[model samples]
Target: MENNTFPLYFNLTMFLNLGSFRYPTFVLCFLLYVFIVSANAVIIMVITREKNLHEPMYLFIVCLCLNSIYGSTGFFTRFLRDLLSDSHLISRWACFTQVYVIYTYASYELTILGIMAYDRYVAVCQPLHYHSRISLRVVYRLVALAVIYPAFSVFTCVYLSARLPLCGNEIPKVFCANWPIVKLSCVPTGLNNLVGMLVSTTTVFLPLLFVLYTYLRIVLVCRKKSSEYKSRVIQSCLPHIVTFVNYSITVFCDVSLSRINVEELNPFLGVILSLEFVVIPPILNPLVYGLKLPKIRKVVFKMLSCLKRCH
Candidate 1:
C-alpha cells in the first residue's frame, strides 16, 4: 500500500503468474530486441552512407526504418526492464510517453508507405515529371508531415487521457498502450473514445486509403505498359506492398488482442499478440528492403564481398 502514495504509477499485470517462464521469456525477448535494433540500424546506416540512395524512395525507406527503431525502443526497453524487476509498474508519464511514441510510429509508417506509393505512382505514371515532383525538398516535407501529424494527434489523445481520473492501475497488457490506458479511466470516457477514434482514422487509415488509391492507379498503368515496365514496377513496389501487408496484419492482431479479455486467452498467445507489432515489423522491414531493393541489395553484396576478401 505504500506504493499507493504515488498514484501516478500503474501496475502492469500481464506478466503475473508466469513464474519460471518469465526468465526464458526475458532472454528470448532481449535477443529479439537486440536483433530489431541492430537490423534497423544497419538499414539506416546503409541508406545514409550510400550517396546514390539519396532519392525519394530510399529516403522514405530510411524513415520507415527509423520509425521501427523509435517504436521498438519505446516498447522493448521498458519490457526488458520489467522482465528483470520484480515489479512491473510504470509511472503515468512513462506510460503516456510510450503511447505517444508507439502510436505515432505506427501512423508514421502508414504515412510513409502512402508517400512511397505516390512516389512510385509518379515515377511510373509520369516518368518525366518524377524528378521535378518528388525532389529532395519534397521528400523532406513528406517525412516531416509523417512525424508531425501523428505526433499532434497522439499528443491530443494522450493529453485527454492524462486528465481523466483513473479508477484502476493494473494495465492488462505487457507495455503501455493508449486503448488499455483509456479503459482504466474512472470517469466517462466518451470524449476520450471519440478523440481516439477520430485520431486513429485521420492519422492511420486515411493515409492507408491514399496508398490504396495510388496503388490502384499504379495497377491500371502497369496493365497498359510493356513487360519491362511491369517488371520495374514489380521490383520497386513489391517491397512496399509486402511491408504494408505484414504491418497491417500484425496491427490488426495487436488491436484485437488488446480489446478482448486476456483471461480467456492463453498466456503465450497473449504475449505473442502483444509483441506482434514491436517484433514483426521492425525485423521484417529491413529484410524486405535489403533483399528486394536492387540498390540496397547491391550495396550489401558488395560489402559482403569486401569482408570476404579481407578474411
Candidate 2:
C-alpha cells in the first residue's frame, strides 16, 4: 500500500471469529474487569485512609494498585466494548492511543516493582536506617522516577511505531501493541527495533536484575538472624516476591507471544497469552497483598466487619 493510501482504521483480526461465543466471553471479561478495578481500588483506599498503614511500603502498594487500575481501565474498557461489537475496527488515532496507555502501563509496572524492591531492601538489610533512607522526600522522588521514566521511554517507542509507513493494519491480537504495528511497516524498522531493545533492557531486564540483587542481599542478611527475625522478614517480603514472580511470568508469556509465529498455536491459547499480562497481575496483586500481609489483612477484615454491622 502507498504511504498516502494508509488505512484510516485497523481491523483487529483476532476478534473476527468469536461468533456465538462472543456474548459469553463478553460477560466473563466484563466481570473480570469489574473485579480488577474494585479490588485494586480497595487496596488503594485502605492504604491511603489508614494513617498507620501510610509507611513507605504501603505507599508503594498504593502506587501499584493505582497503576493496576490505570492499566486495567486502559485495556478492559475498550476490550469489553470490542467483545460485544460486531465490528473490530479501531481508528488509527485510537489504536495509537491504546498503544500508549498499554505500553506505559507495562513500563510503569516494572519501574514501580523496581522501586518496591529497593524499599524492601532498605527495610530488611538496613532496618536502623529504613526511615532515614526512605524518607517522605525520598519516596516522592522514587515515585516520580517510576512514573516519569516509563512515560518518556514508552512515548518514544510509541512515537517510533506511529511514524512508520504501514503496509497493513490487521493486528492479529486482541489489543493494540507496538511490535504488531511496527511489523506492519512497509519500510525497514531497524531503528525501531534497536530502540525497543534498548528500552526493554533498561525498563524490564535492569529492574528484574535489581530485584534479584536486592533479594540476594536480603537473603544474606537473614542468614545471621534468629528464626523469629527470619520469619518476620519473610512475612514482609513474600508478597512482593510473589507479585514480582507472577508479573514476570505473565510478561514473558505476552512478550514471547508477540515475537513468535502464533499461526501454529491454538487460537484460544493465543488469546489467553495475549491477555495474560493485562488480566492476571491486576487481580493477583490485590489478592496477594490483602491476604498475605497481616496489617493490610486486619484492616481489610475490620472494614468487612464494619460493613456487615452497617448492613
Candidate 3:
C-alpha cells in the first residue's frame, strides 16, 4: 500500500458479503433506514413546532433527536454509498472525515446522556429550582457542550489515528471505525489502542458513572417524596436509560473486539452493529419519547388534528 493511494476500486471488504441477495439487502436497508430517520426527524419537528411540548424534558429530547440525526446521517448515508460502490480504498481525507464525523456524533451522544442526567438531578435534588435553574439559557449551553465537546474529543482521536501508518489497504468493517482504523497502523498499535481505550472510557464510562450516581440520589429523593413523584421520577429515567443502554452496547461491542477475524466476519453481525447504531435507536427514540412524556403524545395528536383541518 502506497502512502498516497486511495484504493477505491481495489478495496475488497469481506465484512460486507453481498451474497446472492445483495440488491435485496441494500434495498431493504435503504428503505428501513429512511423510515427510521424520517420518523425521528418528524418527532423532533413536532416537538419543536408544537407549543405545549416546550418543557425541559422535551427540550433535552430535542437535543437527543438532534444527536440521532447526526448519527443516522453519518452511518446510514455512508452505508448506502458503500453498498453501491467499492469502498475499499478510502482516501486519507475521506478516512479522516469519517473519523471526524463519527467521533462528533458519538461525543454528542455521550454529552446528551450526561446533560439528561444533570437535568434529572436538578429536577430531583432541587425540585423547586427545576424551572428556574434549567432555563432556556442553560439548555443552550448544554446543547453547545453536546456539539463542541465531542468535536474536541474526536479531534484528538482522529489526529492521533491519522498519524499512524496503516499496515494494509483493507479495513475490516464496512465504514471507517475508530478502533478499526487504529488497528490498521503499521507501527505497534499499543499506543494508539491505549489512547483509544482511554478515550472510550472517558467518553462512555465516566458519563455513565455520573448518570448512575445521579439516579441513585434521584431514587433516594423520590422515595422520600410523595408516591405521585415516583412515577414522574421513573418516567424521566426510563427513556434516557434506554438511550444509555442502546449506546453502551454499540460502544462495548465495537471496542471489546480488537482484531476482527476478517476471514470469519459475519455479514449479519455487520448488519446487527449497523442497525444497533443507526436503526434501532432511531426507531425506539420516538416510541420512548412518546411513551415517557404525555406532552409529546398530546402534541402528536394536536399536530394530527391541525393537519386534518388543513386537509
Tell me, by lDDT, which candidate is best: 2
**Candidate 2: residue 43 Cα off by (Å):** 1.0
- How well is each residue in 193-280 modelled by candidate 3, as lDDT tens digits? 6776787677777887888898888878877888778887777678888877877777666655435564565677754654465566
Clashing pairs in 1: none
Candidate 2 wrongly placed segments (more than 4 Å): 1-5
Q: Rate the local accuracy (lDDT) of all candidates.
A: 0.85, 0.91, 0.73
What's each prediction's TM-score? Answer: 0.94, 0.97, 0.88
Ranking by TM-score: 2, 1, 3
Worst 10 residues of 2 by lDDT: 1-10
TM-score of 2: 0.97
Scored by lDDT, model 3 comes in at 0.73
lDDT (0-100) at residue 205 of candidate 3? Answer: 77
Cα error of candidate 1 at position 120, Å: 1.2
Better of 2 and 3 by TM-score: 2
lDDT of 2 at 99: 90
